[model samples]
Target chain A: MKNNIRVERAIHGISQQQLADSVGVSRQTINAIEKGRFVPSTVLAMKIARYFNKNVEMVFALEEGD
Target chain B: MKTSFLLPNKCKKLGKAIFVISAILGFYILFIEESYADGFLIFDSWQAVKNNIAIIGSLLGLALVAFSKERVEDELVMWLRADAMIKALWLSCVLVFLCALFLYGGIYFYYLSVAQYIVLLLYIFIFRYNMYKHIKNNEE
Candidate 1:
């Protein structure tokens, strides 16, 4: 899956650590997600989307390869 | 995001400390105890020391669990736990097979002992590294 999480976070001027804390995850998880090294579970993805006040589809999308 | 699943920094710090203490005790037992053997025997001085270490380690581990702040759901915790168990199972099976081959080839007892220790160390290293990576990667 590909996501615009980094861009969204940057636009909101929110650090990854802050976002991670808000969502109850470690900063490393946010880093991994931004780096495309990990895929969050459904619940986590939803939580991220909720934190951004965006729909899940807007934040995360399945790539053609996926 | 939920904060419930993540271990607090204090808990992580305690866990690391416990692991280091346990490792040190293990090394002491392995190197300083002359009567230590692969098989179990009646209680002795070495066994007494080992028992004390085991009890202390278990207490530390339990304390960590008791003091944890974040209450992650069991299901989510199971994901990482299952991964670790799978890794351990695979590694242990391979080590056992290799040990069998060595035995069949008439390797010395010392060689077998060293091999077992190396395998045990490797297993611990791999498990700890994987767990750390998993936790680090998943931090919010």
Candidate 2:
């Protein structure tokens, strides 16, 4: 899955650590998501979307051929 | 979507406590035992002390893990842990093979024993350090 988490976080000036703590996960997880090295679980994706007050579809989407 | 459960802090706490107690008991067994030589191989007083501590600690840890609430694990954290475990296993296996080769080449038994302990220590330290780094980096 491709996500706009990094861009969203940057717009809000929220660090990865801040987001991770809010979601009860390690910062490494956020970093991996931003780097496209990992895909977040549905729960985590929803948490991130909630934090940003955006729909999950707005933040995450399937890439072409994914 | 909110899950029906939260993080299992109790389990994590118990695991940490068990790890600390095990480390302290290990130190005593390694350095403070009277008749350390016998303690290493026989069921002597010091050996008994170590065994009891280990058994109790492990049981408690297992219980905590089994009974605790389920918590979500991030994919990245899981991957890092798996990677660290694989690396540690590989390193330990290589050390064991090297030790066997040395023994086959007629290295003295006493030196081989010391070497084996050193290798075990090194493996543990490396595994722990790598895991810590991974966790820290992710958190930063």
**Top candidate (TM-score):** 1
lDDT of 1 by residue, B3-118 (tens): 35445647846865775686576556655654454434435466766745643664564345333443332223445444655776687778777767766543555445345344
lDDT of 2 at A32: 70
Best by DockQ: 2
Residues A1-66 of candidate 2 have per-residue lDDT tens digits of 899998999999998889989988767778878878778778789999999999999999999988
**lDDT for each residue of candidate 1 in A2-66, tens digit (9 for 90 to 100):** 99999999989999889978887767667777878778888889999999999999999998988
All models, RMSD in angstroms: 6.2, 6.6
Worst 10 contiguous positions by lDDT, candidate 1 chain A: A24-33
Considering the two chains of model 1, state its CAPRI-style docking category: acceptable
Model 2 misses residue B121 by how many Å? 4.8
DockQ of 1: 0.28
- Candidate 1 segments whose C-alpha is farther than 4 A from its true place: B1-84, B104-123, B131-140
| Residue pairs with backbone atoms closer than 3 Å in model 2 (clashes) | A27-B138, A28-B138
